[model samples]
Target: MTTQATLTPAKELAAKNRARFPNESAEYRQARNALLAEEIELRRHIERVAERRRQLPPGGEVTKDYRFEGENGPVALADLFGDKDTLIIYSYMFGPEREKPCPMCTSLMASWEGKVPDIEQRVALAMVARSPIERLVAAKKARGWRQLKVYSDSDGSFTRDYVSADDADVPAYTVFTRRDGTIRHFWSAEMSSEMADPGQDPRDAPDPDPLWTLLDTTPEGRGANWYPKLEYPSAG
Candidate 1:
């Protein structure tokens, strides 16, 4: 039978203390250096994977010319591309059932908001939802997001078309390119559990989520695998 962990008062007290490792022996030092080299090599491999993304062939056909509300009003699908050579459409999963914006999505977009100027210089980035324009705008305001250009697909067809919001497909980060009045898909990323690790770091920047930074303080140490969850409604 599986046993559930029970924390006695003493156990809980012990958990509050930081873990300390013993001094290493000469053999341990040699093994540690070799392991450090392996870690560096693994990071280099991840960098190479990121590099391959830039080399992907650009040509994902837009199956439908979906309309979306722009700052002025209704705008053609192509207008969303702005003036950039590449367009990144993030399919956000905030729907009627969600009740509130997703904290995980919020965390990712928070980083995007700060990079808008730099991103717009080379690529068009937009957050897409299947909700009404007003609803999407309201949620954006609630989240204090100013940098992301929001769009509403109301009909789930856009989500289905891009494989971005299906239960089977997790939130996707996809890049597309336009040529001769045609849009083509370039790259898509959806990391699987096998690819994730205890030390996995997704963001390339030094600045990380303050939420995670704070959570790293406790004994759980971010609890093996974790993602941000909405707190106002006390995450289901």
Candidate 2:
């Protein structure tokens, strides 16, 4: 770990950046350099938060043998770990009562679908819903997602315990760690939409969604009214 005393100041590092655009004004350069310094500090802050998360004490042991319905057949929570010691389960808002899934959850899942294989190399990943196994599989096929491993918490046992007590159609991200054949809850994204700031939407630090992250770089930023949808009209 690098101490703050030994690390160079973000502003000093930004001063060394000589990047220039054609015919750009001096004011633009000065502002950009200032923003660059802030960005550097943001990166350092992210690392510090990650380190703190990794140092968290061991969580509660998962006593119940929760089961889920996978594409192939029934599977237990322990089985989802495969050969990895860590497992990440994303509870998407696709309850049996709803005809379609939540657009926000869909957008997040779509972004992760392509990276599933790469992610599985380090830790097991599962996309779970409160709908039946058949319904979940159908949705996966409709979306043309080949890599994401969809599952169904058919009985809602896992959903009620880890996601929502009322079994509401909400998205959740939970992580579990397996050590010595015992499964334990490691961490979860507990921040809910109700926790959002006055102007900003509820979101976690180092958000997992690439869509919002990409939008953040634009001048317009992630607008208050704009949101992702299940489908968009074809472009001419």
Candidate 1 at 156: error in angstroms?
A: 2.2
Give the alpha carbon lDDT tens digit for every residue of 1-236 in model 2: 55445778899999999899999999999999999999999999898888888989999999998999999999999999999999999999999889998889999999999998899989999999999999999999999999999999999999999999998888899999999998999999988888888999899878999998899999999999999999999997
lDDT of 1 by residue, 169-211 (tens): 2455667888777887887665655655457655322223455
Q: Which stretches of candidate 2 lie over 4 Å from their true place?
A: 1-5
Sum up the clashes in candidate 1: 4
Clashing pairs in 2: none
Residue pairs that clash (backbone atoms under 3 angstroms), model 1: 59-184, 59-185, 60-184, 60-185
TM-score of each: 0.68, 0.97
